[model samples]
Every structure is written in C-alpha cells, then in structure tokens.
Target: MTGPDSHRLVRSPGVGSVVIGPAADGSRRPDLVVAADDAIDWTVFDGLTVPAGYPWPRIIVYEGDDTGFFDWARRRPIGTFEWRPSSAHVVDATGANINRLWIGLRTAPLHLTVPSMPHGVLTVNGDLSLLTAVLADGGACPAVDFQPDTLPAADAVPLRLPDLPAFAGAQHVTVTVRPLRQAFDCASLLQFPDTRHLSLGGQLVNVAALAQLRHLRGLQLRFCPDLTGLPALDSWPELTHLIAFNVEEATGKRLRGELRRPGREWERSGVSQLRRPEWFATEYGLPFSGWPAAKAKKATTAYRTAQRAIATATGPDGVEAAIRAFVAVVNAMPGIETTEREDAGDAVAQLAEDTPFGDLTEDAQDWFDDARDF
Candidate 1:
C-alpha cells in the first residue's frame, strides 16, 4: 500500500495496510493470514473471511486486546474471527437493522460505540470492564443497557438492551445530562410531558425549572447543594421518592409534604421541624404549636430524642452542659406518674345543657365522648 506519506505492503482489495509479508528475521508472517469464507477448517485460526450475504458467526480467538480487532472488523466488515486462548467470539455487523452481537469474554481492553442495535439478545461471556454505551435521542432499538455486575461467574447472561421508545413512553423518564447539556436545553428536558425520575447527579441543571415536570415520581439531587430550594411538588402528585441528601429547610418542607402524607405516617429520619410540625398539633395540623396537648406530647418526643443525643455527646459547652446535667438529675427525681387531661367534651356538654339542645345533637356529642374514652 502506497499513500501520500509513505509506502506500505498490502494485498487485499479495498483493505489498505493490512497484508502478509516477510519478517526481518526472514520468517513468514502468519499474523496477517486470510482464510476462506466457510473455512471453519483451520486448526489455529486467528482471522477469517465472510463472503458477502451471511451474518458473521461467533469467533473465539487468543488475542489479548480487542482494540485493533474492532477497528479491523468494522473496517473490513468480515465474518467472525476467533483468536487463540479465548473462548468468546467476534462479529462484524453492518447496516442499521443489525442486531446480533458477539462479545468476547476476555480481560482485553475493547473500545467501540454502537448507537443502536436491532432487537435481539447481545450476550457477554465475561466481565465488561469500563464498557460504555450511549444511545441517541429517540433512537429505535429494543436494547437494554444491562449492567449485570453481579452475575455469577461461569454464567453468561444475554442482556437485551432496553428500548428507548418504551422508556420514553412511560409516565416517568430519566435522563443523563453530562453529554447532552450542550446540545440540549435543561429547561426543555424538564418539560418532558411524562418524565419523573430526574437524576441530575453531577450534571449542570436548573432546579427551579423542574416544577414543570407535573408527573415526576423521583428526583435525585445528589451533591447539588447550590440548589437553594425545591420547586412546589403539589403539581406533581405522583412524586414519591425525594432522594436529596442536604436540602435546606425550605426545600425539605416541599419535598416532605409532597412525598409524605401529613401526621404520624409522614414522620421520617432527619425530618426537619419546619416542614411538618403542624401534623403533630392538637388541631390535626402541622407546625404543632397551635394544636392541643396531644400534639405537644408528640413534639416533646422529638425534643427528648434531641436531648438524649446531645447528652450522649462527649464535649459540650460548660454552662449548657451543667444545665443539661441538672435537668437530667431533676428528671431522675420524678415523684408522681398520674395526671389526666380535663376532658373538653364534658365541659362543652355541661355548657350545652344551658342552651336548648336536641337529643340528636346530644347523641352526636356522645360519639365524641366515646372517642375520648377510647
């Protein structure tokens, strides 16, 4: 092969710089051998030829790295070739409708990117170290980017890549923004009609615009502390999981209220007092101060828990520590256990006696009376 830069040896048609020649030691080069189309005939074969029409079969070879292999196969469009020492095969795919894939099962470093693969199972025989796949927008292929890191050894699982259309068609959609941030607008992405799982981890994003996702299910805002507050999630009734770690009180409130129901079931680990305190109030509302004594008891539980954590800590301010120790001592000095709340229903009923009360209204008060007894 001769080019503008230099001259190289070659013997194949349309295949440049790929040829068999003599070595410096006068030995023949078997590394560049080309075999017949159906020549599964060779004993120690490293490469093979595919006569036009048929799909490439699996190839098991003994080559170390598959970098050059993929380059040659993609360029030559040959049939499957199996090097020595490897049980896996190689394939040369063509056309947009191609599906079948033959992934080698060695620890060799292979680098190739396929935008789309047709509907089929692409099996990998071994661990795919540092493997990456990126699909285009609206790319058509029922392919699942299966990352089965936990598959048992000697177990070959044929992972079918998930369909992009199927994911896009759901009531929730997730997107990675590292690559498409420049080409696509973040605001436009948030406006996806049915998108829900917006995981903007380590990606440049606009937190406020996310409110446009009316059907959002889960929002993962990991390591995005610069995001001041969360958007109002009342618009997104379907939102369930708020996977934010360090969100401020304002943002946390919105997330808690949207993802959790008010009152007892809503309380969770690290729940801020600002968000749902009313849920523990006497009026069955949050921000519990205005509520009855029952709500005060619930708030007292939280205060007691905080006190225990502080008490268990090693170092404390001298004055505050003394006060806490004194309080603990006073608590240990408990004397009596019984105290009953003045039942308001009885008092209200006694007052109702002064007015003209019907029997039905009295019976309704009896229902309240029964609730208090329970």
Candidate 2:
C-alpha cells in the first residue's frame, strides 16, 4: 500500500505483513497494518500521516513491546485499545479507555499511569504494587485482577490501595495469592459498595465483614482453608451465587446449614448452595462401617469372628476371644482412637452368658461413632 509520502509500505510475506494506505473510497485514510512477530520493526509505520476528518480505528489490540506504540497512538485521536503486553517498560494510558490490560511479564514489575479510563479491566501477573500506585494516583479503573509475584511479608502488612476511593464505582475485583497466604483483609475493600462481583483466594480467614456490602451479587472464596467465618446471607439480599472451596470444616458446615435453612427468605431466593463434605470419612479415610466390599473385607471378618465368639463360646476364654476380635475390628478402621478401642473392649467383656449377640454388636457399633467424635 502507498503512504502519504508516495513510498510503498513494506509487506512481509509471513505473519508480520504490513498494510497501510487509502481505502477504496480514495480518501487519504492511513492504516498502519503490522502483524505480530518476534522481530517486529515498529518503525515501519513511522512518518505515516492520516487525512483530517478520517475516522480512526477505535480498538487497537497490541501484543508486543510498548516501545513507541503508546506515544504513536496518543498522538492520534483514538477512543480505546486492548493492550496485551508480553514485555513493556511503561504504559501511558492517559486519555484512552484500556478495556483490557493483560501484563504477561512473569517476573518484572509493570509500571503504568492511568490518568483516565472510567471503564477498564487490568490483569497483572507481576508485582501488584504497580496497580496500587496507579490507583493511588487517581486512576479511575473499574476492574482489576491482581496476582502478586511473591507472598506478602509475614508482618501482616496486607496489600492496600490507599486511593481505592477513587474507583468507588468498580463493579468487579479478583485477587489470587499463591501458597495460600493472607495478604490482605476485607476492610480494605469497604469503600467499594457498588462492587457486584468479588473473588478472593488464599488464606482469608474471616469474611463476615463483607456482609456490609448489600449490593454484592456473586461471591467466590477459594483455597482459603483458614477461613472459619462468613457474613449472614440475609444481609446481601441481592446475592444469588456463593461458592467456597477448601474452607474450614466448621465454616463449611455453618454455611451449608445457613444457605439451606428452611423458611428463610434468602434461601427461597434461589441462591445456589455448594459445600465440600465435612465428614471425617471423606476428608481423612474410609468410613469405619459401610465401606465398600473390596475395602471392608478385613473389618467384616473381625466383626463376624467377634459375633461368633460372643454367641457360641462360654466363660472367660470366650470373653477374651470376643474382646480381642472386637479390638481387631476397631484397629482395622481408620482414625480410631485409643479410648474407643478400650471402650469397645470393656463393652465386649460385659457380654453375659445369656446376652444376645445382636445387643453386643450394637454396643460395639456405638463405640465406632465415639472414635470419630461424630
């Protein structure tokens, strides 16, 4: 394609092909068409000029370094752009709406200034302090996904946005931390009452404070194994989706009961309830009783042997055999405690000569429940 200078724009044969010129309407419309490449010489589009009154492209998807692209684009009158930078030094999002900013740098910190953009979504995979600084500088972005490069310091110094009030209109926010660390508290987000969706992962312990946000509609808590408390569901009448994974056992049970409470208006609101099983059998090992045939053979044998000894044998030798058999059955079970084994032994010894084997079996089964504290 021909440029304003009458020079032919170089069109590479491969993916990095360039197309720049006037449209079929014969207007002096400038189009810097460059493909993504490992060795993209951005200077190829230099010196190109657009005719006045020509409609500029509103959305520019950039996938390479920000060498001179921002400066070049800022000079033009564009509306918005989606920047997916693999490696960039600094982004000057001063006057455009960066709809989606994906920082793919795995190690280095991303530095950017967001003086505008009332509606923007930022996804950073490096040091999150850059985002905090941007927000501190009056950047009015509405959505952010912050995944820090390393864990926060152990002093409980959470990552905070002192100027979060600047973006009080934010609707969505997501924070993920690796190795499951509590890098922040819920209080930091109290100002964003307009937030409709929120997701938090890692060691967030207590989320009961979030009940204050009555506008929240969707909440997801993941990998927060230390989390033990939740806000009342009635507070967030607009909430329709609640999901939690790997939370504390007590908290899971409480949430399950609360979300499924009969006759509650919130429960009738069709809020989806999901919970991980809180039973010891699912968490640690197989259930002492009701185990599948392949897994319960040894326990079954011990139980049957104990019943036979209690029913057919007589005197102290029979009582001893029955106690030993019961102890074997208890030992075969998982998470069995010493006190439970002793209790089962005592119960078996109490079996009298005329005692029904059925009664003795019931007593032994009761000890299994005590072993797991169920």
Please report the candidate that would top lDDT against the real structure: 2
- TM-score of candidate 2 to 2 decimals: 0.46
Candidates in order: C-alpha RMSD to true structure: 27.9, 20.5
Residues 1-374, candidate 2, lDDT per residue (tens digit)? 12344344443333222323222221223235333333343344544433543333334444444445455545554344444444435555565434455554543445666545456666666554444335425555558676655442324655553444445777787877632233556666777778888888755533666887789888877655445557766678788777766555666666667778775444223222233434321321222233445435654455556656767765545645565655556555664333334334433433432344333445444443343221
Total clashing residue pairs per candidate? 23, 0
Which stretches of model 1 miss by more than 4 angstroms? Answer: 1-185, 203-205, 257-260, 263-374
lDDT of 1 by residue, 300-372 (tens): 4533443454445444332234223323332332221111112223222322232222222264354334433
Question: At residue 351, what lDDT does model 1 achieve?
Answer: 25
Q: What is the lDDT of residue 74 in candidate 1?
A: 42
Model 1 TM-score?
0.28
- Predict model 1's lDDT versus the native: 0.36
Q: Model 2 misses residue 175 by how many Å? A: 1.2
